[model samples]
Target chain A: MKFLHTSDWHLGRQFHNVSLLDDQKVVLNQITAYLQDNKVDAVVIAGDIYDRSVPPTAAIELMNQFVETVCGELGVPIILIPGNHDGAERLGFASKQMKGAGLHILSNFADMVTPVIISSDIGPVAFYGMPYNDPELVRHHFKQSVSSHDDAHKLLCDEIKTHFNAEHKNVLISHCFVDGAIESESERPLSIGGSDRVSHEHFVDFDYVALGHLHQPQKKGEEYIRYSGSLMKYSFSEQHQKKGMTLVEFDEQGFRSATHIDLVAPHQMRIIEGELDTIIEQGKTDPNNEDYLLVRLMDKHAILNPMDKLRAVYPNVLHLEKPGMLIGMEQEMASAKLARSETDMFRDFFLEAQNSELSEEQDKAISDIIKQLSQQ
Target chain B: MKFLHTSDWHLGRQFHNVSLLDDQKVVLNQITAYLQDNKVDAVVIAGDIYDRSVPPTAAIELMNQFVETVCGELGVPIILIPGNHDGAERLGFASKQMKGAGLHILSNFADMVTPVIISSDIGPVAFYGMPYNDPELVRHHFKQSVSSHDDAHKLLCDEIKTHFNAEHKNVLISHCFVDGAIESESERPLSIGGSDRVSHEHFVDFDYVALGHLHQPQKKGEEYIRYSGSLMKYSFSEQHQKKGMTLVEFDEQGFRSATHIDLVAPHQMRIIEGELDTIIEQGKTDPNNEDYLLVRLMDKHAILNPMDKLRAVYPNVLHLEKPGMLIGMEQEMASAKLARSETDMFRDFFLEAQNSELSEEQDKAISDIIKQLSQQ
Candidate 1:
């Protein structure tokens, strides 16, 4: 079976108040284009299809367009699960209805046992989806003592094992924070008061574990257990990580080859660091000026409407970071203010109010008033 | 052709701060029950499936469930249009994908001309949907002088006519406010400044005109033209009108019979009017006290915690109206203040402040003080 493994779409997410719908659309079109040419048996979406429970209408429309082109038109079956970001009930709404159309959504705990078995050369590869569920839900479902995500996931895998056939190769699709996996600024924490970390050992029993919840494309203890990563760089922290999907090809022997296919965003996410003037001067001849940028200024002095000036050159500059420069500038100003005498401070204020410096006699009278106050 | 016509679901709507989801689910269950037993050729939702453009996640789930049950499990075709309340772009998502599964969402201006032809007993019933569109859309669509809704709709119908086959028995499923239809509080005004009303003559040529946008169920200029009404009573203004769907049966010639089937709600909505004590007394013995109620208090005197007291008996009381009693009390208080002498008013104030009556000397001193102040 050749499976296109991708996850953590985070549709409807806004970056620093700017809508990512246009960026998302461009990336999704690229995904659909790959599906159009590739003879992929199925597409496995690990989880986190949406950024939130209630996505905006445009995001919903984009998802619709993607599925219509991939599943409806391209005739590829998509296996999906709901991540912590998605509303399980909302995402799983028409699972049965859309199943016949090759959109298999494994969101409910009750139906987790029933796998989406697609026939491949390696025999039927059974796809199991374990959507991100809380410990409370896990406890209620299995009547087991589940205090953490680890306990919940272990119990879930145990249940799936009783139903899963040992003869067939199984691909476990899940969305959870596994131990040893890296974290990103974009991923919402699974739990607040308790640990949501699940051990990767529990999933290693399966032939392959397709995971989500982290944005970086990396493997677990074993190379077979992998996170295909998100479609785009969701945060500045993820600027260095190349976003992509995993295309897994298998034969009769099973686990033949898994390759990382890099997906490109129309506008690259970059952190441009330099003095404000240097960056602006570079932008004058810079070919990639339109890329989404976070400028880190090394300048010690304050600038007026720095963002406006930067945007005049680099139109897509999203954020301006001063780093330690602001604190250093503030300390310098504080010391300079302390070094000046109170009379000099008064003279400065007088100068500011009258648009001129105080006269020598006026300054002397202010000093005499200060001396008298000091005596009292 | 037999068509089960319904409209104005208004999902995600809240009545007087209380969610109507439970009520909506109850009525939807009833509709699905009817569909389960009857041979419904096609289900036509005229428009307004949701109460707002971006509905709550729960509302989206409900819509998903409804479509899955109707089009997926029941194997029936549903033709729907986006009304003024729905975001056309959001609702129209996956239209092409779900078309084969029998959920036809006619939301786009470009797709409005293309009819969903379902073969019925009489012939192919060409269902033409005209979603509630503003004048701007109409003007942009046709590049014509479409200044008002009337001009817009006339042009739209003209466009549909050009593509529509004359031989087919056409059913115009629209969400426009016809000139002669009755209005209700729940129905949103289609236009802000100009008239949204389209002439009945513009739609007279169709075999049967199924309309929405008006909450009250009634026939328009002709017998064939009708509003199926909303699924439930959305407002207290519709207290008297029986909420239901229209079942239109057709023959070889044209429309044979159009019957209105009444739908029942779990908790009946009612407006109770009387004094608070009497209503409470009635509620003491009333079995249907849990029904949603809007009480009109006729008590002239001030009643302490009247709503709290009424809710003790009728737990589902949503609103309590004082009506003319508050106005009357305010007027009485104003007149009583006018009639009272200055000294009398001061004595009353003194008594209120000290929780004791003012002495004759104190009252006389106050009067003397007031006279001195007036002279000054």
Candidate 2:
């Protein structure tokens, strides 16, 4: 079976107060088109299907439209789990009834016990889903001691291992911050004060482990365990990420190759760093000036509303900063090129401190005090 | 076709800070048992399936069990909508794909145009649904001037009327507060400031108008326009109400009789009034002390730790009150049978105000002041 692996769609997410709805729609269409062109048998979305537990209406509408087209129109089956960002219950509503129709939402501890089995040319492929469950809730439901995310994941995975059928290929889809995975600013911490990580060694028995929660889109210790990353750049800190999904091919023999499929959204998040005038000039000639931008200026002076100036060229500039941002003292520091007299040093220090030069009368008083000190 | 009408399950709801998950499960099982015994063809839940958009896990588990048994197991088709309490977008997720199966959730304005048709012996029964949408969202989606609930409902109903099948029996399932339906305290107002009521005249054309929101389980101006009410008593003010559902029988002849089916939950919310000692004495033999109780004391004295004492008898007593709850002054009023001396009245007032009697010096001062006032 050829499966499209994706996670952290974070639908209804915003980029610096700008709605990513249109951008998300454009990229989702790309994924759908790929599914059609590539003949992908199924789609595996690990988790973080929505940006929030109670997603915005537009987000819900977008998800509704996407599922209707993919699962209903395209005839491709989808297996999804709810991430920490999701309300598991709401996400899994009518999941059992919808399972036969190709949309399988495996959410909750009970879902872990039963796998959603799918047929392939080789025979059958069993997909086990472990949706995100907090430690306290896990303890209550599993009737075991769960003080950390590791305890929660280990206990669930251990029990699931006993239910695995040896005849078929087992694939585990989960939404968790695996130990030693790269972190990103966009991801909300699963636990506030405690550790929110689980070891990947627990899933070594599975043929393939598709993961989410960290938006960097990297692999764990092994090649089979990987994160497909987020749909787009949700934070400026993730400006360098190659936002995309993964494609996994497997058969009766077990896991095969996992290929990376790059998805370029309508707009890219980029950082433009240079002198104010130079960057503005670059923006005028740049074809994709509409990209979401964070500008860093190298100029020394305090430019009057540089954001406004930058925005005039690049309309999507979200933030701006210069070297000496605190007191605007870069210009004064540059002027101090030689060893100076006490009066000159004192004058420069006074101007920098109080934003004003001393009057002639004050200067005379300072000179008199200096002369007295020198004689003594 | 025989239909079981119910709404406002309010799963995961709490009563006076106590979780009613068990109570809700008991009542929902009652509904399911009714479906099995009566052999109803279809189930129509107008709205408020959950107390909150994101319900508790146990509530979700209960609802999941209910739908799985009712729709997946028993093969009874269920039609539900989102009420004011529900997050429409979340509640209606994958509604389109799930429609082919027994469960049909119509939770948006577009659903108003397309009715979920169920087969009957004579012909088809078209069930048009208008889920609760805020007037602002209605204005945005419908692109019309809808500033009130009246406007919102009328516009949707008007649009739905155009698509009604003349060959079939038409039933309109909605979650709106009709103008004259008596409301219960537990029903959250659809709108806070402005009117949250729609005119029942808009729904007159439908053969049977099944509604939710007013938890009284009563009819509008006409008997055909009925509310199935909630699954259980959600508020103390609804103590006198007979909590139940409606049963509608329809065919080619259009609407028939709408019968009220009384559903007795395990616990009934009731108010017990009398002296504390008398009620306690009665509680010794009152087989159903587990019923949620609100005690209204007729005793004149301030009993020490009345709630603790009351809970010993009626273990579920939620509130305690007396006629003179504010001042604890009923005892003084009761002792006013004789014309007491001025000193006695002053002494009593002083004792009540300070919680202590006048000392020798204070009594002498008060007597001297009264003597001077009398002389004046």
Candidate 3:
């Protein structure tokens, strides 16, 4: 069986307050074209289909169009699961009725026990979808002593394993932070104090484990375990990561080869640092000036309306910073000691208040008042 | 052909900060039971299926369950339109694909021109659904001169009339305030300055017009034009309004009798007025004390923690108002003139400052100060 593995679509995500719907549409269209050209059997979206629990109307419409084009128009069976960002109940609405249309969405914990068996040329492939689960809710639902995410996942996976048949090859699809996996700024922390991660060893029995929630495409200790990563670069931290989908070809015999396909994003994210004048000059001639940017200026002097000036050339600049300002601030803190003495402090106060050194007559008047106050 | 007409589900509505999901479930279950018992050919939801454009997770689950039970389980065709509260695009997401499962949702103006034909024992009943359309958007979409909501509805109805066949009996479903229709507090004003209302005469060609947006069940001048009201009492203003579904029986030639079926709500809304003590006494003895309540106290004296006291008996008291406080305020306003005189105002100020009436010594001192000031 050949299947395309993808995850973390985050359809309604905004990049630094800018809507990414158009960019997402471009990439989704690319994926749809790939699906049409390739001889793929099915598609498996691990999790994080939406950026939020309540997506905006435009996001909902985009997702509807994408799903319709992939599963409805392409006639490919797609299996989906809910990630930590999604509200499982909302994502799973009408899921049962939608399965007949080849869009299988598994969000309920009970549904995780039964595998969706799809027939292939070699034999049948049993696909198990485990959605993101809250440890507290899992504990209450199962009446178990699972206190952490790892324990809850293990318990859930063990229960699912019991229903697995040895006759057919099994594939487990999930959305979780696996132990020793790389993290990114965009992926929300599943729990406080880093106790949400589960061990990758739990899925050793499965032929392949397609994971999500880590926006980096890389294999774990085994080649069969991999993170399909996000559909696009959601943060500056993920700028170095190659965004793409993973394809796996397997059958009843067990393991097979997997291929990674890189997706071309509509726009790239870049970080640039230099003196304000130099950066402005560079921005004028830069080939990728339209890319989203985060700039840091090293000039000591303050630049007037820096953002407006930068945006004249780099229209997509999202953030601007001045590292030299912090250095100047530290120096100003050291010079503040001169204002600690009463007379010198008064002189400094006069200079600061008046935005200049006080005149000779004004200084004399201040000294006379100080003398009178001392006498009192 | 026989059909059940309903609207204003407001599935995710909150009353006095309390979730109405359970109450909505009760009413929807009643409607479901009614459909199973009756020989209805189809079901039409005029509009306002949700309280907000982005409904809560529970509301989405409730709506999905309702649609599944009606269309999937009961095998009945259901047609729905979007109301002013709903984001039309979001509500209509996947609607085109959903039609294959006997569920028709019309949200766009273009779709409103076509009718959803349902074959019945008598003949084919053509159901035209017009979702809530902003006057500006309607003007732009049709590229016509429609300034007010009436003009938009008239133009839309005229377009829909062009598609109507003389052979089939037509039913028009819409979500707009009809001219001269009575409204309740629960219904949101469709537009500013009441320009959102449309004339009922626009639907003269249709055999039956199922309208929504007004939470009062009443026929407009014509018996064929009606509003099904909301699924439940969403506010105290609707305390007297009987919430239910309208069942219509008709043929291809003309209209038949329509019946209003009252739905028994899990909790009724009530408003009570009396003295605090009397209200408490009544609350303790009233048979329907558990119902949601708005209490008005007539006691002339202040009551301590009146809401807490009332809740002990009537646990669901949502609001409390003191009518006697207004009368006391008026009396205080009349007496405030005594403080206008300089001597009396000084005395009152002294009394307030000391939290007690002025002493004879203080009064004499104030009089001496006033005499000295006047002479100066």
lDDT of 2 by residue, B1-376 (tens): 7898999889889898888889989888888998878788899998999999867778878988899999988899999888878878877888877876788888877777889888887689998888888889889997999999899888888899889778878899999888867989998888776499888999889999999888989999888999998999999899989988899988668888899898887889998888888999999899999999888998766789999998998899988888745345754665564467577779999999999999999999998888888789
Stretches of model 2 off by over 4 angstroms after superposition? A15-19, A133-167, A177-181, A188-206, A251-254, A300-303, A321-323, A326-376, B134-155, B190-204, B325-376
Ranking by TM-score: 1, 3, 2
Residue-level error in angstroms, candidate 2, position A196: 5.9
In the range A1-376, model 1's lDDT, one tens digit per residue, is: 7999999999999998888889989988888889888889999998888898777878888898888889988999989999998888777765676777888888888658899999876689999999889899999978889999999989999989888786788889999888878888888889875498889989878888899988999998888889999989999888899998999887776677789998988888899998888999999999989999999998887888999999999999999899748877898999998899788888888988999877889989999998888789
Native A-B contacts reproduced, model 2: 0.62
lDDT tens readout by residue for model 1, B255-284: 888999999778788999998889999999
Q: Kindly report which residue stretches of model 1 are placed more than 4 angstroms away from their true locations once superposed.
A: A192-194, A327-331, A337-376, B327-331, B341-376
Off by over 4 Å in 3: A252-254, A299-309, A324-376, B165-167, B328-376
The 10 consecutive residues of candidate 3 chain B with the worst lDDT sum are B334-343
TM-score of 3: 0.87
Error of 2 at B17 (Å): 2.9
Q: If ranked by DockQ, best first, what sequence of candidates would result?
A: 2, 1, 3
